[model samples]
Each structure stands twice: as structure tokens, then as C-alpha cells.
Target: MLLGFQDRLFGLTGSGISVESGLATFRGAEGLWNGYRLEDVATPEAWDADPELVWRFYSMRRRETMAVQPNAAHRTLAAFEKRLGDRFYLCTQNVDDLHERAGSQRLHHMHGTLFQSRCVLCGRTFADSGLYERPDSMPKCSNCGGVVRPQIV
Candidate 1:
């Protein structure tokens, strides 16, 4: 309770919240991820082994994330944050933008974000909503002339 824990820190830990917004879980019964394994697309080693494949995987994820809107639970969390202000905090494992779209300001993406990317060579990150379906179409980092990768943790 807020009153009971007024002198202590209160926070919320949320995992798998993105699934309620129609996004698939990483280890769910999905054909693509389960068939390929998470290491092939979610790790820095995987990106080094095959950057193109990684791009393709994240591109698909970005498209799917872009298609869905925040669910009622996400909206409720956002509303709750507005009410609780600094007393409430949200940490999520989901990479989707559902929480942000729902208007949550006191939230932290524990995994990373699907709508943003970073440069492996320069460490510059930017908002990227465009689908890079083709490997050749993947944006190049303007700062270092290196391949830009998804900014997910």
C-alpha cells in the first residue's frame, strides 16, 4: 500500500506485458523465433555472425510492433502512473512501444525499444519506424559509416 510503504521505495516489475498488446513472446510458440533460437537474433554475437539476418529478424519485429496498439492493461498502467506520479515506477521486459503509446511517463524499458536503433560503430541512437525489410535497405550510421543495429537489450 502507498500509505504503508510511504517511507520505502515502491516499484513495479513487469514481464511479458507486450503479449497482451498482440506482440509475440520471445520464447513463445512462434515459428520464427522458437525455430531459430533467441541467440541468433538477440545477442551481439549473433549480430557479429550475421548482421543481415539480425536486421531481417528485427525488421519483422518492428513491423509487427508497429501494427498493434497498446492494450487496456497498458492504458491502466499509464493512468496509474499519472495518478501516482513519482511514487510509481514501471520496468518492463517488453521492447514494444505499448507503454509509451499508452502515455506512461514514469516507465523504463528493461529490455530496450523496438522503435529505436543504435549504431554499433558510433553508439548513436535514433528513432527508426521504417521497416528495413531488405538487408541492403538497412540504414547506415552516418557518424561512422557502419551498419546501424536495433537498440534492444
Candidate 2:
């Protein structure tokens, strides 16, 4: 018996796969969990309580993520996708663009992405590559003048 395309080829990845690319996995012994608490930056309440801190945190992350490049494993996966074409499917839990940068177009980002921002009020999302140099420089929603937040899940 043979399986269909969707069932025949599948790829799933997470932060661990990109850890080799110099990105932190946030779950290992040296993960960010040791240095920062989720309550301080990962929650909506935290954002409301101190948006500056949140912005700073994300700004730092954006800077860090932008500095790194996709690793061999990432490139390999992308090549595999090109070879498999529509038969290949990828799902990632990472917020970085290593996979995308690696050239994988048939992929789904399960945890959202770091380079995208969403407007809190209008709920519009746009691609962002610029580092938020300062909290004050954070971009605002053009549609509703609302605060823009990272589009990560």
C-alpha cells in the first residue's frame, strides 16, 4: 500500500533544530528561562504593566535574531523541500526566519515569527525587519493608531 503526498512527506522542526545556528532554544540548562521570567515579558499582562520593558526585551531579541545566519541543517531542510516540492511539508515552532531564509516556502510557523508585528487595536500585521532602536521608536498601527506588538505566539 502507498500513501498520498500529504502522508508521504512531512517535516517538523523547533528551536532545537536551529540551536546550531546560534539561536537560543529557551528550554535548555542555559536557556533564557534562567535569566528571565515569563511573567516579566511573555504575557499580555506584562506588556500592559510595562510596555517599555517588553519592547526592550523584544528589541534585544530582534537584534540578536537578525545577527545570526541559517545553519547547515536549515539549508539542508530547505534543499530537501526544493527536492520534494509539494510533497514536502514543514512545521516549525521557532519564531526566527532561518527556515525561510534557508529557502523553505512550504512551511508553517506554529509559534508565529519575530520579524512581524501586529497592531493591538486594528489587528493588522506587517513584516518588520528594522530593530526597534528605542521603545519610543516602536512603530504604531497606521490603521487605528494602536500600539504594535510582536506577532509571536
Best-fitting candidate, scored by TM-score = 2
Q: Per-residue lDDT for 15-49 in model 1, tens only?
A: 46777777777777664563688788779899889
Query: Which residue pairs clash in candidate 1?
Result: none
**Candidate 1: which stretches are off by over 4 Å?**
1-15
Model 2 TM-score, all chains together = 0.87
Residue-wise C-alpha lDDT for candidate 2, range 1-153, written one tens digit per residue: 245455547889988987887877756565454367766777788888977677777777778888899998889888777777888889998889999998999999997888899998989999987666575787788889999988987
What's the CA RMSD for each of the models?
Answer: 2.6, 3.1
The candidate scoring highest on lDDT is 2
- The lDDT values for all models are 0.79, 0.81
State residue 151's C-alpha deviation in candidate 1, in Å: 0.6
Superposed model 2: Cα runs more than 4 Å off: 1-7, 28-35
